[model samples]
Every structure is written in structure tokens, then in C-alpha cells.
Target: MTFQVARMNEQESAAWLGLVTVCQLLPAALDSQLKQDSGMTHFEFSVLSVLRFAPDHTLRMTALAETTSSTLPRLSHVCSRLEKRGLTDRFPCPEDGRATNVRLTPEGRNALVRAMPGHIDTARRLVVDALTPEQLDALAQVTAVIRGQLDDGRPARGNPFA
Candidate 1:
């Protein structure tokens, strides 16, 4: 027997649209909230959080940019802003004079301490509270699938090549 192809109905269309909406909207919402509540943009928050986990709360600028998925120029601009706020320190790397290192200053740590609670609350409100346990598990699995495909030289399941 041959399979009959059918077009997606309105409900299917709505679900597809909703998934896109959540993906796009949630980050913007979180960024706005973080900026309003903590004076930190989400990108800036990511940089700070990454540095927080590094040894002595420092990382080479190139490494920091990579970890944050940012370009050096963009990271440098953010670093400059953070520096103005006295939240970070930038110095030439002692081990490699040609490289630069960024470190979280005491004030930066304090800012992160204050901002984290609000950021967590916002994340919960926008994401965690909205997902069921089953959905969360599914999402994790789906994300892994996508990442695996990216790493394994395979197209994702939906792609014709895969």
C-alpha cells in the first residue's frame, strides 16, 4: 500500500508557530528582564558566569570569547563596558605577553551574586515553570540529537540527506 501525504492542519501549524515563538521570544524576554533588574545584558551575564567558573575567576580573552560564542571584537566591546563599571579587570597575560586576560573583580563577583537570584527567577518563570517533566526530558534528548548530528557529520533527522 502506498502512503498518502497530507498537509498540516491548523493545529499543526499553530504548534509549529508556537515552537518558533518560544525559541525566539524567551531569550529576548529574559534579556529585557535581566537588563531591567540587574543592569546586565544576557550576553554580558554569560561572560561573567563563564569567568566565575574559571580558576581564579580569570580567562584569556580569546578563550572567553569562544566560551561565550562571541567574536573577539564583540567580547572586547563588552569587556570595555564592564571595565567602565569596575566589574572586570583586563591585563596582558603574564605567560603570553601577546594575549590578554580578563578577570572578574570583587565588584563583578558582587554584581553576579546580586543578579543571579533574579536571573534564576526569570529563567524559571519563562522556561522551567512552563515545561512538564516529560517535556523537559524530551527537550534534553532532542537537543542532544541535534548536537550529535552537528558533531557527527550527519544532517539532522528531518533533513533529506539524513
Candidate 2:
């Protein structure tokens, strides 16, 4: 099969460039802040935070991967690191021998709690507080549409703010 690529016009090119720039820079900034303040990467913090809010602070590894938008191998690597740090534990799911589950340790929860303030402050400084209320709502709506497109119309799991 062959397809022709539609060339982006100047306005579309500018918008695309802006989006790409934000995508590239935002994670690094967040990662830097989290690393310096809490000794965790943004991905690690996200993993722990998701588990922190999960029922019984546990989730099947597949569910955790979906929640974090991570691949299984990447999640496994992160989980291994977390386990070594005593932040999480991975075990075979009791209901399904072939599946794995991860639970947040008390240390993980404490790390998340400690990380929150700096994370929120950085987010606000970089994105949230920079936008007006109307802009914030519009940003949410725009991103939701784009995310839906990227994810084959599937809504993202769980409360993003949580």
C-alpha cells in the first residue's frame, strides 16, 4: 500500500512545531524538578502516584501500563527499580497465575506525598498559571480531542489530576 503525504501549510506547520516543542521540553523540565526535589523521575513518580490512588494501592501490571501510557517492558523496568528502592512490589496475580500485580509500598506513598508540592508548583509555573481560565478550559478540550485521536477514540483511564 502507498499513501501521499499532505504537506502542512505555514499556519499548520507553526502549530505543529509549537506542539512538538512543548512535548519535547515539558517532560524534561518535569523530570528535572522531580529528580532534584524527590530523587525520582517523572515517570517513576507517575507510576507511584497511579498506584497510590488505585484500590488497595495495587493494580495488575497490564492495567498499570495502560494507566501510565507505558509499554509492558518499560513498566517492568520501572517496577524493578521501584522494587529495589522499596517503593513497590510485584507479585503474581492471585486470580491469574500468568498475570502480575504491583502494589505501592508505604515508602512510595510517602515519596509521592513529598513530591507533590514541587510538582504542582512546577506545573503551575510552566503551564497552568500561565493560562487564563478560559484558555485552560480550551486547552483541556483541545488536548482531549487530540488524545482521543491518538488513542483510537479511547478515553484515557482514571482522573488525570489524581
CA lDDT of each prediction against the hidden true structure? 0.84, 0.92
Candidate No. with top TM-score? 2
User: How do the residues 23-108 of candidate 2 rate in per-residue lDDT, one tens digit apiece?
Assistant: 99999999999999999999999999899889999999999999898999999999999999999999999999999999999998
lDDT of 1 at 156: 33
Q: What is the lDDT of candidate 2?
A: 0.92
Best by lDDT: 2
Give the TM-scores of the predictions, in the order they appear: 0.80, 0.94
Model 1 lDDT tens row, 1-162? 999899889998997798788879977987898899999998888888888888899999998886776799999999999999999999999999999999999999899889888888887777778999998898779767756865576443221100
**RMSD, one per candidate, in order:** 7.5, 1.9
Which 10-residue span in candidate 2 carries the lowest summed lDDT?
153-162
Candidate 1 stretches with Cα past 4 Å from truth are 1-19, 149-162
Candidate 2 residue pairs in clash (backbone atoms < 3 Å): none
